[model samples]
Every structure is written in C-alpha cells, then in structure tokens.
Target: MKNIIYFFAAALSMLTVKAQDFQGVATYESKTSMEDMKKFSGNNKEITPEMQKMIEERLKPMFEKTFTLTFDRTASTYEEEEKLGAPGDQMAQGFKMMGSLFGGGGKHYKNVKAKTMLQEKDIFGKEFLVSDSLPSIKWVMGSESKKIGNYTCYKATAVVPVDKSNMMNYRPKKGAEEELKKKSEDEMKKTNFMDMVEMPTERTITAWYTPEIPVNQGPANYWGLPGLILEVSDDKTVLLCSKVVLNPKEKSEIKAPKKGEKVTQAEFAEIMAKKMQEMQEMGGGPGSGRRRFGG
Candidate 1:
C-alpha cells in the first residue's frame, strides 16, 4: 500500500507539471577555471605569478560567459550572450582570439522529440552549421538531492566521451600519428601523457536537476532528464542556472541557427583536423603547421 501511494504521488507530480505549459527561459552562468592550465603550463616556460595573473585576467571574458537557454517541452535552443570588449596586452589578446576559434561559444539547438541537433560553429572566422543526431548520454540516476534556488534538485551522472563535450582542436599528420604509436613503451617510460598530453577520451559529467520543474531541458548538449538541469559540472567547467523565468511576458524565439554551410559533426571534425594539420605544418601547435583555411 505504501509503494502504491508513492507511485501515484509521482504520477500526480508528473501530470501536474505537464499540465502547465513550461515555455520559458533559463539563464546560466558558466565559469571555466584556469587553475589546471596554470599548474600544467606554469613550469613549461619562464613564467611568474604576475604573468599568470595577467593571463587569467585576459581570459576573463571567455572564462566567464552568460548562456541563455530558451526551452519548451521538447525543443530548446542554447546560445552564448554577446561578449563585451576585452582588455589585455597583445599576446593575451591573441590567446583570447585563439580560444574563440579553437574552443567554445556556439549556438546549440536540441529537439528531444525529434532526437536531432543543429549547432552553429565558427572555426577561424568560417562558419559551419553542424546538423546531426543528438548524442545520447547514459545517465545514472543518484539518490542524492539538494536545493538550487527555489527548486529542489536531484543528482545524476554520466561517463561521456570528451568529444561529446568539446573538440580536441589538434590534428597530427598521418605519418606523425603512426610515429607516435611506433614509440616503444621503454622510450615513453619517462614521459607522462597526463602532464604532457591532452587525453580527452572520456569524462564523468555530474548534473543536478530539479524534479519540481519537470522539463527535459538543459544547457548546452545536455537534456532528457525528468526535470530541468539547474547545475552541471565536468572536468573543465561548471554551468549553473542563475535565473529561470517561466511563461515570460514575451515569448522567446526558439529557433535553430540556420546560417553557415551545413555539415555533420564528423564532417566538421575532419575539416578541422585537416586545417589544424596544415596550420601545424606551416608553424603552429607544439611543433609547427600550415595555415590558410581552405584558401
């Protein structure tokens, strides 16, 4: 009898949330910590604490971003707010620009009903509309619960591939890749892949969701939860929902980005790989590379 009562309570909760239209917007504040980079690259070259501080300040705009997630029952669009002007030295400024090109800040659209996604990407000024199937996450539900703002939240976790969260942005030559594999275990005995290489094959993502607001929507490429995800943390970053407005006076224009040349995720990866290889050949990355993006 107790179990039956609990089941009906859950059913009632779900039905209540579903009865009310959940068309609104959630604003998220994303912060990227550079402490990891500082520790790794601190001794890579001659650098001082003040210098590190300068780099951190320069990366402020990119590290601290505001993302708006406009969502409804099964369709949602997430995009970063326009950035303000940045202040830094020439080198810092250059690094910031490089981050914009190689790293994040893109418009992402997810449709749970259709199981599809349309993402807009910018690689070195060239735009690409990446259209593909939504990557599924095998989320393991947890018994933990917490309160986020006015909503009571529960926990969930997932072991996701690194690429599902972000791109590598590094592409070695065909021969170089083979050469790396050819290295004997004895030869690499002294070298540490953890401290030296970017091993982003897998990552564990932890998310906090609010069952009170039962909507399968979240920021970025995350969704399909029984409720809206209010906070998510991974290896490199944490995105928290700072504000949520339900049934806003003005209806949001939730539309997938239609600009840029259409390409699949794999297709975009190949293009980026080719471009990186060429750039490295000319004079880039750790070694060197060529530039000229399809020029």
Candidate 2:
C-alpha cells in the first residue's frame, strides 16, 4: 500500500508539469484597407494642394488605425518580420509610388506606436489587452478548420465598416467648412455621388486554436475562442506566431490603461474631433501627438 501511494504521487507531479508547460509559435493575419488614391488622382490629372492635403488627412488616420489594430496582442511576446505591400500589380505600383512621393524614397510610410495594456480578462479568466489603437470594428469567424503541422485550426471573419458618423468634436477653421462644401460639390459634379450607405467591408480571419491549451486570448481585440489563436489569416494579410514560450522563468503581470482622463466612448469621440480641429489649425497630422507617457 505504501509503494502504490508513492507511485501515484510521482505520476501526479509529472502530469502537473506537463499541463503547465507548452512552447510553440502562433501566427496571426488580418485583411485591412488602404485608401485608393490612384483612382482619385487619375480622375484629376493636376493634383491641387488642397486635394493633396485632403488625401494626406484622410489616409493618415485610416492607416494609423489599421496598423495599430492589426499588430495589437497581449499574450506571448512577438517580433514583426517585414510587412508586405498590397497584392496586385496596380495596387503594388500605387503603393510604391505613394511611398516614394510621400516618404522621400523610403520603402513605405508608416508611423508606429507600441502600447502595452496591463490587467484584462478573456475566456481564460484574466489576461492583458496589449494592442495598438484601433477604432471599434466588427468581424466574424468562418466555418473552416484544418491541421497546421500538429495544431487544428479554424476560420473566423469580421467586418470593419467605414465609419463616417462625424465622431470628432473639433470643427474645421472658420473657412475650412466652406472649402469642404465647395470640394463636395465639385466631386459630386465630376462623379456619380450617392448617399453613403453601410457596406460590408468583410475580413475573413482564419486561425488555428487548440483547446488543449484552453486560453481564449489572442492578438488584438480578438477573443472568445476555445483556445489560444496559434495562427491567423485573411485573404490579403497573414500573421503567424514566430515563437511562444509558456510558463516562462518569470510570469508576466498583465495590467490595464489607468492613467488617461477616463471618458466614455462618446466623450472620446468628442475629444478626438476637437483634437483634429486643433491639428488643422496648426497644420499637424490628425493624430493626437501626445503619447500615453508612462507604462
């Protein structure tokens, strides 16, 4: 009886060690959007200063938001390799030209901000919300599953609708509104102008998660899965986990954003609007130039 009890204890210890030990790479990918400046520029051969300014203003926010959300994740550290440009000859050329024109011969133009969120929760009970800034966009998972190497994977999809609800509180300068009105009218006359409607800008994200790990956390705002997302992708983009080390030598303590002047989502919109107005006045980018300061 004594020998049997000792044997049982040893087996239990081994099981515990296995349950808490895992090491693998997770890859995540997402489909995103970029402004079609080529179309607009093509229609108007002579790009006016105002048109250029408008293009920069519009594309800057969209790019900023997309880049932030696409790379945001709280679990398992990662290192981004190289970012590929949009697929297709025309699109690729357009991006290259734009980069050269705007970036002064750089490969691409991007302003990246790295942020870390401490304490958060997911299906795994508690986690961190480590991600870049992204506007509230929705997506759905698709019905697809497969085995990548040794892991079973599934597909998920979501839609990021074009938000045009005038969420900003800042108004343009005294004469800027008049300029916009004139531009609107001119644009209408030049092209088929229809009332803006909600369209399905769908992004199908497929991921491989394993219930064996039992953690719902994933990169960005994506969660609610049965297990951690090991690999993810959409039609145009792909993010793969390069490496994962579970049960590290030191545990990572997740925390949340606590310093900012806390405000409701609506209030945030208002603040953003006001900030935009201030930027226009100062001839700065639409971004709030202030960083979160401390971690």
Candidate 3:
C-alpha cells in the first residue's frame, strides 16, 4: 500500500511539471438537499402537504444539476449542461431568478497562474461579465482516503464565508419570530433583507481530489488542491464527478468570457443586493414584515 501511494505521488509530481501538455473534461452532478426547503415551506399555512410535494417535485431539477468542467494546467471553464424543458415554465423561471442570487446561469472561467476569473451571467434580460481575482481558499489536508472510479482520492477541508443571500445556507433561527415580535412595527419594517431568515456566517467545505490526475482544478469556486478534485461537499450541496475524459481527441478552447457588460465581482454583487431589496420592497421577498422566504 505504501509503495502504491508513493508511486502515485511521484507520478503526480511528474505530471505537475508537465501540466501544460495535459487537458481533460470532467462531468459533475451537483445536488442540494431539500431538507431546508421542506422546513421553509412547512411554515407557510397556504401551502398544503400536497402543494409542498408538488413544488418540491417541480423544483428538483433546479436543485439537482449537471456541470461540465474543461481544464488544462493553469485554467478551467465550468458551466452547467443544457437540458431540455418546456418553454415559459414556472419552475424554469423560478430557477432563473434563484440562479442570479446563487451565482448560477454562468460560464465560470478560472486562470490559476494569473489568479484571475471571468464569469458570464445573464440576469433578467441584461448580461454581465464578472471579472475578478480568484478567491484564495485555505485547505487543510486530511489523512482520509477513498476511491472515486479507479483513482485514489484524499480528503481536504476548508472554512469559507457564507453568501448571506444564498438560500442553501439558510436555517431557521431558534428565536427569530419572537425576536421580531419584540421589535416595534417601524423596526420590523426597517429589517434588513438578511435579518428575516437565518443562515450560518461560514460553512465548512470538504473536497476529495485524486493525485493521479495532477491538476489544481475543481468543479466550481474550488481549487488550489494538490490534484484534480473529484468530489466536493458543503453542508447542503454535493458536487461529484461522474465521468472524466483526459486528453480527449477534441479539446474545447479554454478562454475567458468576452460578452456582456464588464463589471467587477463586487459590482455584480451590489447589483444583486439592490435587486433583492427591490423585490422585498414590493412584498415579494423576505424582510417585508409579512412574508418570510427561506431555503
């Protein structure tokens, strides 16, 4: 066993040195748990058990997705696989709206060497090109090991700040209702968008990477590993690589997105926040002092 491990480690080092000659494609299936969704809907009196089940069934496709990652040595592009669905479908529209908040509906390109990232997003009818530096994640390697396909994978973990608007991180606060009840009407009306629902301030991420592949790339917003990441899990969602094709005959061009109005990551985030505020003001979102939407 020690010899096998050493062999793979040495092979990984060699591949790392010759990474420029490498190219690959990985297919990942991402699924978010519906536990929070069920709890959130349970709070609504108007939504019966049947209605909740129907909603869950309809929204399953949105929460469960497949993405393709194309990568070489220093850069990678990750995007969702297109699926056929009915036009003007309510669930599709819901997915589009939620996608903007969750940073979906985009082609994400990351350049590891340059420490840069470019993402193309379409919100409503407008398109945006989000340009930014790659986020640095501090991963603590673990001794745990497992097999994903024929490759041996090792575990690594990191703690990352949560996106407050992302529903996946949401949980019901123990005393959120009582706390709100104690506040004056004016205070309630002035509640910030994030105050109505509770979510963690940070989340721990677990990733499994295979040294045999020898690439510092992962599915989405995850990298800087010693090898190619095959699986990643954040409390609510899991992204697992289902298929890998290395050095395929046809390699797609890896390039940064060029379309859409250029904006920094911060600028795009501000735009989303403002849009959420607008929705809340119209009583369509949380913090409206009447309706509270949760994950």
Candidate 4:
C-alpha cells in the first residue's frame, strides 16, 4: 500500500513538472496606401463613393492584412509554430499585379532566409539564424502589461527600415521588359535606396510578449527578445491573441517551409521572371480581361 501511494505521488509530481509553461498567440497588422490606385486607373482623382465601395469590398478591414502567430513553448526549446491561415498566395499575386500597374518597381511578394550572428557582446556572442534581414528596425520596450487569455503579456515596438538592397526582384512583362532592364542597370549604378532615398514611410510595429513563456522567439523571423511576442501591430492594422493551447497531448515539431530551392536575391529575380511569364501566358496578355472581383 505504501508503494502504491509513493507511485501516485511521483506520477503527480512528474505531470506538474511537465506542464506547459508558455503558450500564447500574437497578432500583427499592416497597411498600404490606397492613393496608388489612382495611377492604375490612369486618373489622379479622389476616390469616388462607388470606387470607395469597391475598394472597401476588395480590401475589407484587415484586407490590407493581419497576421496571427501562435507559439507553444512547453519544452525547454520552443516548438510547434503556425503562421497566417489566410490565402497568402492569392493575395501576394494580387499585390504583384497592383505594383506592376503602378510602376511600384520589383515584386511585391518576397521570401528570404539568411543567417545572422547576434553579437551584442553582452550575451557571450550567441548567434542565431534569423529569418529575414530588413534595415531600419528599432526595438522599443513598452510600459504596459495585460493578461492575454491565460498568459500575462508585455509590449514592445520595432520599426522596419526600407532598404533598396532589400527590394524584391519582380520581373516585368515582355513589353515592359526593356524598361525594367534599364531601371535595373540604373539602380546598380546609384546608391541603394536605403542609403539615399528618404521616403516619409515608416512602419511602427508594437508587439505584446510574455516573460512567463521564457523563450526568446516569435513568428515571421522576429525573435531574440526577453519573451515571446504574443501580439503585434502597425499603423494600419492590429492583431490580437485569440486562443492558446500550450502543451498538447503529444509532442509537436516546428519546421520552416521547404517548397523552393534556396537562392540569392539575384537568382530569385530570375525565378520571378519565369513565374511572371507563366502567369502572363495563362492570362493571355498583360492587360487581360478582369476576372470576377470578390475578396
């Protein structure tokens, strides 16, 4: 009888120790300017009521886009992450078309993976392979804390810098290919836009993270903070944590996408060209007839 009691106590203690220590959801919102649409219509006019309605329908709230990030950090090392559940591919294609029509330069959709060694000299020169490297990023600690579902959350801010070196490679149509080629050569000669261009554009990203989670990682390449980011926001949109399931009944694995071969930014441009050509062929031409419009 004593042995059975000891076994039950040990089992209970093990369950308590193995319980999920960190689990939460993070939200992010981002917006784009609507003024560029005028150029597509070939008229620099104020948005009309009818056009506004159409735009609203196409770009409903969060249509500009929002990201929901869920993290499960029950283990010593974080794991089991999921990204945006929306139709990202279709939306990316739409943005690419819009950019091309407005001379926005380059592809609107880009995916890059790079290894970065974080050397602050304070953390013993620990290095991690960060996902993407964008210029003009600022990490701001916020003075707010709140409970997001079951986990307590804190806030932080980051600014994403715009660098020409980070500009994506988007290929133009056959008719516009010559122009793009010239522009590309010119870009090569000039200083990178990040170095010279001074646009009034700024992306202020506010994130809500939790110290209770004790893991320094977040969705979409943002990490290395004191806690996991549970929410993120920009000037245009807001994402909030909705649901969090910490330790599931079984172990989970977290992995990155492995659809395309790894390539440099230049090689990615070539791939974009081939992809654009395929799309053009499917559509029958550059100014193809409009398809059914529904978000």
Candidate 5:
C-alpha cells in the first residue's frame, strides 16, 4: 500500500511540473460542403453553368480555411491563419455580410481551469468581446480508435446545446416563403424573422482525441476532453489538425482577449437576432427568404 501511494504521488508531481512548461502549436484545416449553399440564395430558378461556377469561386475561400491553435495546460487561443488580404475579402459581397453572422473573425480564447471562454469578433465593422462560461459537454467515450499521423486517437461523441446566435445552426424552414406569401402585408411586416429559419437547439459532435498530447484542448469552442482533440466534426463542418509541434521553442502567452465592448454570449445573440430582423424588414437579407447563415 505504501509503495502504491508513493508511486502515485511521484507521478502526480511529475505531471504537474511538466504541465507548467508544456505548450504546443497546432494547425487545423476546416472544410464544409457547399451543396446547401444555394438554399441561401432563395432563387428558385435553375442556375446556369456560368452562375454556378462563379458562385463556387466566390464561396471557395469561405468554405475552406486554415486555423492555428496555441495552447498551454489550461488556456488556448484559436484564430484563422493569416494570409494575403483580410478574411472574407475574396468572398461574394453578400457572403461578406453573412460572415459577421458567424463567429470566426478574431481570436477565440478558452481556459479550462477557469471554466471561462472569451472570444474577440468583428461584427459589421464593430468589435465585440464575447464572454461566457465554457460549453458543458458530456462526452461519451467510444472504444473506436484510429491513427492520425503518429498519434492514436480515440473517438468520443456528444450532443451539445447550440447557442441561439450560432449561425451554423440556421436553416431556412421548408415552405417558409410560400407560407409568408399567404399572409397580408401587415401581417408579414409584423412577422418575427426568427420564425422563418430553423435553429436546432442542440447538435451532435464527434471528436477524435489523442491521449499522447495529454491536454484538454481543441480547435474553436471545443474542449473538455481527456486529451488534445485532433479531429472534430458536426453535421456540416470538419476540423482536422494537420500539424502539431509539441514544446516548440517559440511559446506565446495564452491570454484572454480584453479589447472591444464586453457582452455575454446570450447578449451577443440577442444583438445579432435584432440586426438580422432589421435586415429582413428592409425586404432584403434572410427575411426575404434568402441569404441565411448555414452550416
């Protein structure tokens, strides 16, 4: 009994010491399907080959992106990898407006020890610092395993509650436009734009983590795993870690974003909901049965 206790104590001490100095940089490639993108256009007419090609060209930059995650034991920052021109610059003009609807413009910081999340976002030329509690994920560990590079990863799954502002969950309800057409103009004017779109209250997430990394960290808002998450996917998007450099010579400070107006995640959602409604009322945007943010 004494030997077992002493061994555990020694191991715990080693882990603590190692965690103090451990940091890593991981690069992830994110990709989403464009098949559903046409739904956002609200154009029932069949698309010409030229129009289809043009649309794909414009959306290519938005659908495919690279991000880097810098992390320590308890905290991390994830941001899109810097490239030529600003983000969304190459996207179609309409998509650039919808870009603000998604929350990927700036650094996303998460601290596991503090159970807090802070994200910096640029919305319609204004900056916002969104603060909130970390997402509570009850991951169901699966026995399935796979090899991602040299690391052996185990699968885990969870159904996570989606924030009301998460544009990824927005899908135009079926026949919403036809139903709207039947309403009087006054009724339509008074209609709540949110009712036209469907936002699933929760979404299923599948994550593959590697125990070899020994850190509860991942890309984007995902965390709370037994190890570092290497690959994660929801219904439409997949984030796969393409490269990981453990204990690199250059370590960055994992600090939470302090700039921009402070607001809770719920408050941010409300602000966006109102903004979207306003756009709808103008006979444009999502309310016109067009240009909705989608996964």
Candidate 6:
C-alpha cells in the first residue's frame, strides 16, 4: 500500500510539471467573406466586370490574412504577420501601387488572469492605446465536438451585442459642427450617410476550444473559455488556427502595449466618430483623398 501511494504521488507531480512547461505559439489564417458586400451595392450600375475583378482582387489582402498568436498560461497577444508581395503579376502590381493607401491595424492583448485587455490602434497618422476590461461574453457550452489539427475541440455559442456608433467614426470639425448644430437628431440620422445601420444588433459568435491546453486565451479579444480556442467565427470573419507549437523552445514576451494616447474604449469611439463625420463633410469617401484605415 505504501509503494502504490508513492507511485501515484510521483505521477501527479509529473503531470503538474508537464502542465507548467506549456507555452505555445499558434499560427492562424483569417478570412473575411465578401459575399455580403455585394448586397450593399443597390443596382451597381457603374460596376463593370473589369472593375469588379479589380475590386475583388484588391480585397484579397484585406480578407485573407495570416496572424501569429503567442500565448502562455494566462495571456495572449495577437498580431498580423507581414508578407512579401508576389513578383511579375499584374494584379499584384496593382495592389503594390496602392500599398501606402491602406493597412494600419491594431495589436490586441488580453490577460485573462488579470481580467484586462489592451488594444493599440492607428488612426490616420496618430496612434492610440485603448485599455478596457476583458469582454464579458455569456457563452453557452455545447456538446458537439470535432477534431481541429491535433486537438479535440468543443463548441460554444454566444450572442454578442453590437454598438453601431462605436464601429464608425465621423467626428465633424468646428465649421461642420457649428453648421450641423442647427439640425435635429432625426435629421442627423436621415441625412447622415455611410451605412451605419449595422449597429443595434446581436452578432452571433461560435467558438471551438480544446480543454487539453487548459488556457483561457485566444486570438484577438476572445477569451473566457475553459481552454484554448482553436477556431472562432462570427458571420463576417473566421479565425482558424492552422498550427500550434506547444512548449516552444523560445517563449515570447507577453506585456501590455503602453505607448499611445491613453483612452477608454468609449472615448476612443467618440474620437473616431467625430473624425469620420468631419472627413465625410470634407468629401472623404470612396477615393476622396482620405485613405481608409484597416482595423
């Protein structure tokens, strides 16, 4: 009986050591579907087949992207990977010509143990770091399971609240603000263009996580899970982990990004909203000299 007890204690210690040695880097492929964008163009009369092809081709780099998520026991950081442009292709050449016009995304850091999150974003030429509480998602665990890569993952579903005003930025300048002050709120919504109707909806999120990892971290702002999220998707975008290296030889530095204009999420949204409104007033939309910033 003493020998049996000693053997069981030794096995438990080994298991704890193995769990402690777990640090992983996951490579994810992200894709955003463009089928829904077609619905927005009500009788696109000016859209020729040639124009459509060019638009579709340009959308590739935006929709199809690769990112790396470095995670440990309690936190994770997600950032997009830079890629080399292809050579000797007309479509690629076209994209390269407009390279400086787009691509300014943010870095996301989530610390589940601390219940904190930090987002570093770039607006035009300015950088801002928005810190907020970890998103509170009420996830309903599901019995369905599937194998993604080497991990057996279970499904979880949630309905996330969408704030439309927070998603768009349209802050008006002094002159526009003064002129716009005379208009009522109803008139503001009627004349205000740019399709801000996506607000006030419940977006569904479906996630698949594996308990084998036992870390409540995932790419971007996703968290509050019992294990590592292998795949997650909403209607427009999907993040799928293509490769995960557990106990990596080199562990990445996990720290919060603190170099930017400090602002809360709500404050940042207000700033963006005012900026967007001003830009639109100055004839800024669909090739109006104002470049579109990537998220």
Report lDDT per candidate: 0.71, 0.38, 0.78, 0.42, 0.77, 0.69
Identify the runs in model 3 with alpha carbons over 4 angstroms from their true place. 1-20, 176-195, 286-295
Error of 1 at 153 (Å): 0.5
lDDT of 4 by residue, 207-234 (tens): 8886655555554445655666666665
Q: Candidate 4, which segments miss by more than 4 Å at Cα? A: 1-47, 61-138, 163-203, 250-252, 264-295
The candidate with the higher TM-score, 3 or 5, is 3
Sort order, TM-score high to low: 3, 5, 1, 6, 4, 2
Candidate 1 lDDT tens digits, 1-295: 9668756666765775565465768999998776655544454334578887776776677678889999888899998897646465555545434543435647889999999999888665677899999879899999999878877789999987665324332222335434445456564444343223343567789999987678888988888788899999986689999998877888877787898999997787677666655654554452222223466
Better of 2 and 5 by TM-score: 5
lDDT of candidate 2 over 206-266, digit per residue (tens): 5666444455556543455655566655443344544444444544433234332434434
- Residue 26 C-alpha lDDT in model 4: 44
Best by lDDT: 3
TM of each candidate vs. truth: 0.78, 0.42, 0.84, 0.46, 0.80, 0.76
Model 2 weakest 10-residue run by lDDT: 103-112
Q: Write the per-residue lDDT of candidate 6 for residues 192-268, one digit (tens) a residue.
A: 33542234456889999987666788887788888789899987779999998877777778777887888887787
Tell me the deviation in Å of residue 155 in model 4: 2.4
Which pairs, if any, clash in model 4? Answer: 26-230, 136-161
**Candidate 6 displacement at residue 50 in angstroms:** 1.8
What TM-score should be assigned to candidate 6? 0.76
Per the 3 Å backbone cut-off, how many clashing residue pairs does candidate 6 have? 13
Better of 1 and 6 by lDDT: 1
Q: For model 6, give the 10-residue run with minimal summed lDDT.
A: 163-172
Residues 5-95, candidate 3: write the lDDT tens digits: 8797768655654856678999999999887667545555557889998989887877899999999989999999877668877566556
Q: What TM-score does candidate 2 get on C-alpha atoms? A: 0.42
* Candidate 6 regions with alpha-carbon error over 4 angstroms: 1-21, 84-104, 163-197, 286-295
